[model samples]
Target: MCRLSGTKSKKEMIRVVRTPEGEVVIDDTGRKAGRGVYLCRRLSCLEKAYKEHRLERSLKTDVAAEIYEKLRHALL
Candidate 1:
């Protein structure tokens, strides 16, 4: 069996955001023209992302409560 080291084997958690105009996508390239938030694919990252509003800041817009809920559901 092949075992990977720490962080390398971990799944990279990225944020997929849907715009008000309805665009669902991953913002890895950081050039998407809509709101975006990032997570480390970990529960902690998701929580922190919400608490700190990292996603909102990244996307440069105010996020809606429904969007937050959706993100939480998707992350979990």
Candidate 2:
């Protein structure tokens, strides 16, 4: 489900993952071996998540700026 919007449709979402090694990354495959949280495929959700540290809260890891940049590109 989308963390910000509470949307259940994953067809329009992005998978952000916290790997076993504690790395936070965008899971393009959606099958990465780790914990993950979904966010709506909208710039607004991305912005809010970035500013509010929602992904970090959910994944229990620190999300880097580059990952947000990658997510921003993926949304477009």
Candidate 3:
């Protein structure tokens, strides 16, 4: 018989959330009505998102400190 890995072990899954104002929120579920982008829960992915400003670029707006915190917490 063959066995398959569990969903919990899938470290490459990414979730996408839509924002209230047509923006995307990456990683956190703060109950805010905004688009969200969920990358693999990894430091490297988080760093890449921040460094590349993908979140801001995608949201088409500036990212605030609190938002960054929320993302970090979710990613961590």
Q: Which candidate number has the best TM-score?
A: 2
Candidate 2: clashing pairs of residues = none
| Candidate order (lDDT) | 2, 1, 3
Count: clashes, candidate 1: 1
| After superposition, candidate 3 runs with Cα above 4 Å error | 1-18, 21-34
TM-score of candidate 1 versus the correct structure, residues matched by position = 0.53
Candidate 1: give its CA RMSD in angstroms: 7.3
- Residue 12, candidate 1: C-alpha displacement in angstroms: 3.4
User: What's the distance in Å from true for residue 31, model 3?
Assistant: 9.8
> What are the runs in model 2 whose C-alpha is more than 4 Å off?
1-8
Give the TM-score comparing model 3 with the true structure, all chains together.
Answer: 0.53
Q: Write the per-residue lDDT of candidate 3 for residues 1-76, one digit (tens) a residue.
A: 0022353332353454556665445533334566544455666776777788876766667776676677577666
Pick the lDDT winner.
2
lDDT of candidates 1 onward, in order? 0.58, 0.82, 0.57
Quick one: ranking by TM-score, best first? 2, 1, 3
Query: What lDDT is reached at residue 49 by model 2?
Result: 86
TM-score-wise, the better of 2 and 3 is: 2
